[model samples]
Target: MPHFRIETNVPKSKIPQDFVSKAIPVLAKALGKPEQYCVVSLIAEVPMNFGGSTDPCAIGNLMSIGALGVEQNKKHAKVLFELVERELGVPQDRMYITFQDEPTGNVGFKGTTFHSLFG
Candidate 1:
């Protein structure tokens, strides 16, 4: 089975349960894998300024979600953007998301080893 990893840049204080509930299923569906087979890891970063004019409030609320090597990372990127926009009330342009592919062995799941270890 293909492995998947999700690295999110949200506030450390933010509840992981919130992200996990939404993210796990999205990754599983996007990667065409069973939800139970997927692994998710999150890395929270302190909020940072985006520079230039936009919305200070929005900039302060910036977050990034990175999904590593699913079947359709790019497509999932779009989905993630939309999801953040709707969930967090941040504009699509204000949020950032990305996906990358790694060597098969570089990622793992569960006790068997996959992209990440969520459970």
Candidate 2:
């Protein structure tokens, strides 16, 4: 249930055209989740400013039911930031990533919450 989303100030045309397919496995590995269950969404050309300046920057949001912790989060951030930089040419120093552990009951799919199936 790891849904990795990125909001970047870079234009969509500047990013690698095949980023979604390239990012799926990356996110899956970062979350230790199955590739089929991982979803990645990218929003480019966002009007965002990091460090009070307008430069190539991004903010990533990783949401999952579990598999997020201090060490895992740091590792994920490094991997995610690298992917962003490599794919979009966004500097890693200008990126900020936020991790969220969603409750099983709060996440739903196919008309059923994960809480019902696993919790």
Per-residue lDDT over 35-81 for candidate 1, one digit per residue giving the tens place of the 0 to 100 score: 77555554445344444534411321111222344555557666666
- Model 2: per-residue lDDT, tens digit, 1-119? 88989999998779888998999999998788999999999999999999999889999899998999899899998899999999999898998889999999999987999999888
**lDDT of the candidates, in the order given:** 0.49, 0.91
Which numbered prediction scores highest in TM-score against the true structure?
Answer: 2
RMSD of each: 6.9, 1.0
Clashing residue pairs, candidate 1? Answer: 107-114, 108-113, 108-114, 108-115, 109-113, 109-114
TM-score of each: 0.55, 0.95
TM-score of 1: 0.55
lDDT of 2: 0.91
Model 2 misses residue 53 by how many Å?
1.9
Query: What lDDT is obtained when candidate 1 is compared to the true structure?
Result: 0.49
- The true-versus-predicted C-alpha distance at residue 13 of model 1, in Å, is 8.4
Give RMSD (Å) of candidate 2 vs. truth: 1.0
